[model samples]
Target: DVEKELEVQIGMKQEMELAMQMLEKDICDKQDVLVTFRQQLDDVQSLNHELSQKVQGSDNVIRQKNEIIARLEEKASQMNCTIKQLEQRLRQTQSSCQSAEEANYLFKQEFGEKILRLQNEVDLLTKQRSQLEMGLKDKKLSLHSDPHRINGSEQVKADQQQMADMKKELEQLREENLRLRQAGEESPSNGIHQSSRSSAEAEKERSTLERQNVICKLCEEEVSVTRLKRRCHNCQAIFCSQCAINELPLPSSIQPVCVCNPCHRVLLQQYSTTPPP
Candidate 1:
């Protein structure tokens, strides 16, 4: 019985040693798990710090972009206003140009009509002068043929009176011819007396042609428009008030509504019975 009791004691001692070794291995495994958890926590903290820095940079970029957009919008508004002002100025300039063109066209039309009328009058005067020259030649021939008939004192006296009248008419004709020549020599473009040019120079000419329907018989100059009193529409005659009173013919016995001289008798008369309103 003593041997059996000793064997039980030895078995109990071996179990106690085995239990102590298991407890030591369990403690070492728990320490290794705790170290792994701490390393994972450190990695998470580093990632969070980097993420916060990226978010801050993104916010700053957004703010700068918004400011740039605002500036661009402001500049666009200014450009739009400038464009509108330019359009308005362009429209006004076009209107002014159109008005100027219209005025120029009207002036040109009036001047052209006056120039044509003046040319016609010059042609009529030239024809009259030519006819007078023919008449003078005929008179000279008649005078030469009647030498014997004009030898008597009474006959000579009559011939002298006729000759004097003819001389006066001839002198008037020469003066008229000289005036026409002078007018022809004066350039329509510059109003200066000059030689004639070829047809090509006509393209470059700028003339201001004026009309004159009235001429002074004594001075042989154009009558002043400011001093004109009566105008004959048919003959286009402008006469001073005194000249019209003295030159107009009067009826002998019967009183006529209108009295006209020999030159204007055939023309349609427009008598001014009253002053202009």
Candidate 2:
């Protein structure tokens, strides 16, 4: 009986020990599972925080993009308004240009007639001036031949004064003709193309006048058309370079200047009598 009881007690003690070991193992496994769960929770929380920051940054970027879009829209609106204003101004300018063209055409027609009449008068006056100059030359020659002719001296003086008045009138008429012709040809209200065309016509007129009317005053060599580029600085008469080759000093000039033969001779005589101060 005592032996059986001892065996039963040992078995019971072993079983209890084994059961307690199993319970402790189960407890350790539970604690490990809990720790794993806690670690996983911590990882989840960190990931959530990072995701929150990214979302916030994304939101800020989206807001900035919206602001930029709004500003761009405002700029576009302002640009459209400016374009409208420019278009309106362009239309007004085009209309004004058309009206100006019509007015300019009418003005040219009226001034054309006036300019033609003035040109005819200038030609008549020029012929009259030549006759008067010839008459004066004849009178001067008669006086030189008969030095005692005091009676013709007063008449010569009167004729000279009349010639001077006629010359002044002729110069006035020429100026008026030039002004009327310029007005007929050129207008400030004209377009740039019109202005350029007018300038070309003026150049053509200048060339024609040079060809028809302007002859070398000194060269007298009558070969119909000679290019007259040089003008006498003293007498302002157009001449060839060979005709006015001499240089002389004048009171108005800082240096020696090219003068016509007649002007140069007069300057020489004056200098001989009274030297430059």
Candidate 3:
């Protein structure tokens, strides 16, 4: 009986040991599941943070695009205004040109005979001037090659006197050209006269636009625009008014326009050579 009791106690002890072992294995399994759940939660939080950063970056790009759009709209508005102003000026210029053309036709009809006679004289003078220039050049080259030619001093004096005479003739022609144009310019043609006056004033004002110091091509004088420098209509060269004092009619316009003296001279020669219409 004591041995039976001992066996039963031993069986009970073995059953308790088995139950303890099962409980420990179950606890380990529960711990592993909890650790897996914690890892999943951390991964979800990281993904949410990444999505927030991407959203903020997208907002910045959208804002920049809006600013660019506003600037473009403003620039387009300014350009439209500029185009409108240019169109207005074009219309005014066309109207002024038409009035000048009518006046020019009247002047041509009135002075046709006188102009022909004057033009014939101009032709004779220009031919003489050309011959004189050629002769002077030939003499200069000869003197340079052979220093022993007749005293350069005497020859030079005669040449200078001849040049002076030619210069006088040229000046007369220049004066005649100006007088002819002025007659047309001063004609009491309503819009034409006013347009000519305004054009001259505008030319003077426009010439003063350059801010930086510029040297006059003819005089080589440093000029501050407000006082003197002007552009020649014929040559498109800048010079002091003193050097470009002559006024002549441009081929395209009937009104007398400012031109450099050299250009005025050349223009006279060319006009003299051309046959009258």
Candidate 4:
């Protein structure tokens, strides 16, 4: 009985030792799991810090972009204002140009009417002078034919006084003609300065005048009929058919063109000398 009791006690001691070993193994496994959990927690905290920094950098970039957009918008507003101002100035300039054109047209019409009236007066005066000259010649012939008649002697003295008066009137007419010519020359220059702002505009006005058939340069008469007027090829001067002195050959044209006396003289002087063969 004692031996059996001792074996039972030994078996009980072995069971206690096995239970302790199992408890220690369970504790070590639980510590390893805690260590792994701690490492995972540290990794998660580092990832969170990196994400916050990235978020802050993105916010800073967005703010800078917003500032640039605001500045660009301000610049756009200024440019629009400048564009409006330029448009207004352009409109004003156009208005001024139109007004200048109207004034120039009126000035040209008035000047043309004055020239036509003056030309008519000059033609009438010339006709009257020719009639008076013929009358004086007839009176002189009658005086020579009838020398002894008392009435004829008195008539001859009266005709001599009339001739002296006509001479004075002719001198006055010549002076008036010179004054009118000088005025005509100065008028165009004054009109150009007052009305034209650009060379292109002045050229356009001159072309318009040429197309309108204003006057003959030689006769100072209005050139209303195309058939009666001729233009010189060399000098581009307009003259009446009666005033044209000759026809000249031009390299560019097939037909001969009429020329004024001055241009014909110039051409003769230029080509009269024979070339060396």
Candidate 5:
């Protein structure tokens, strides 16, 4: 009976040990699973951060687009007002000239020039109206071309965001070009064009001048375009890169500065102003 009792106790101990081993293994498995879950959570958080940045960028683009649209609408209204005023002026001028023979003779003499100017103004207004119409059309086309409408509903926002960014950039470029044109018309001095020299000698001279016109040797920023980018470091007044370089101290090892015909006198004045050591 004692032997049987001893045998039963031994069997119980073995079963308990086996249960303990199984419990230990289960705990280890749970720990491994927890570690994997932590890693996955970290990855998900990082992805969320990136997605947030993209979302913010998209929002900024949308805001810029709305601003551009508002500006375009304002410009359109102004053009319409100008057109009405011009038409009134033309009618009044025509009526005044019709009654007097002397006025009519002078009007006839000036009619060709006056008519040309009026036609030019009308054509400009028509073009401005057409541009606004096209911009509106582009916006509509972009809105409708969203591929997301065919797919899942979630992508619609992203597509709209992308289209808005593109339109904003286009509007900015157009506005800049318009401002440049207006500035050119107002100030003839601001209008500068690169002369296309055909001859090799002229091309060489042009190339030399072009190289000198760069603001910084390292960045290769053009002095002419530099005015639009930023003010000159030396004069605080904006000049093309070539103009800036011309003001730089010439190295004994390097050649003399290449300047445009107009800038030559300025360069001479600058040289004369330098006090001798």
Candidate 6:
């Protein structure tokens, strides 16, 4: 019986050895699978890093494009403002040129009228001078023919006085003619410069000179000087009171500030068409 028990124990030992061998083989297969999984995980991590770098580069390119667009928009706006300013300046220049042309035309018309009026006055004066000369010749002939009948007669004395007064008037008229000729011969630039004086300043100077008994510029006749008399605001020349009343009449609104016919015409033209400031 003891022999039989020993045989059974030996058989059990052999079965246990076989089971241990099978467990060792299964453990070796599982280790191989774990190594393959670890390699795959490392590859995935490398790919993810490369993708992140590409995304950052794309973001930088987009940011640069946005900045360039903003700069182009700002430059366009500046160019628009500059173009508008240039257009406005061009319009202003055109307006100024038109105004200057109108002023030049008016000045020419006024100058032509003045020349015509002066010519007429000269012709009238010449006719009057000739008539006076003929009257003096007739008077001289009568005086020589009746020498004895002159000194004692009142009519003879009156005739002599009248002759002296006429001679003096003729001399005065000649002087006035010479002066007019000189004034007409002056340069246009000089005349323009003289005319540019402010009217208010001219009036002030004229008033101050009136107190000093200023001579009449046209007729050369001495008279009481006042603002009521005819005066040229341009040349600041006083005219004889008798001539002023007959020849140059002042506007009611501009009373006591009488301008000559030439000056009055200029003022009328300047005020009529000039645009309001």
lDDT of each: 0.47, 0.67, 0.71, 0.62, 0.50, 0.55
The candidate that wins on TM-score is 2
Please state the error at residue 198 of candidate 2 in Å.
23
Candidate 3 worst ten-residue window by lDDT: 188-197
Model 4 per-residue lDDT tens digits across residues 190-263: 23232223678746744554567657787687765432566676788777654563553333442335567666
Task: Give lDDT tens digits, candidate 3, residues 29-83.
Answer: 9899999988998998999899899889989989999999999999999999999
lDDT of 6: 0.55
Model 5 root mean square deviation, Cα atoms: 40.0
Scored against the true structure, residue 60 in model 6 reaches a CA lDDT of 92
lDDT of 3 at 212: 42
For residues 1-277, what per-residue lDDT tens digits would candidate 2 score against the true structure?
9999999999999999999999999999999999999999999999999999999999999999999999999999999999999999999888887765565556545554554455456556655766777788998999999999998888889888988887898788767755654563455334424212356874675465456544578656432443444557788877654355445445554234567756765655554344212
lDDT of 1 by residue, 67-156 (tens): 999999999999999999999988987776565445433433433344333333433444454455556556556667765544453444
Clashing pairs in 5: 212-242, 213-241, 213-242, 215-241, 223-240, 223-241, 224-240
Best by lDDT: 3
**How do the predictions measure up, each by TM-score?**
0.37, 0.54, 0.41, 0.42, 0.35, 0.31
RMSD of each: 18.3, 15.5, 16.0, 15.6, 40.0, 14.3
**lDDT of candidate model 1 versus the reference:** 0.47
Tens-place lDDT digits, model 6, residues 1-277: 8788888877787777877788777788878887887888788888888888988998998999999999988998998999999989889866765664454444435444553444346445544644655665676667678777655345545655665665566456545544543443342312222123478986886566555655666556565733234566455667644333222212322112445544544554554454533
In angstroms, what RMSD does candidate 1 have relative to the true structure?
Answer: 18.3
Minimum summed lDDT over a 10-residue window in model 5 is located at 247-256
Please report, as a residue range, the 10-residue window in candidate 1 with the lowest summed lDDT: 251-260
Winner of 1 and 3 under lDDT: 3
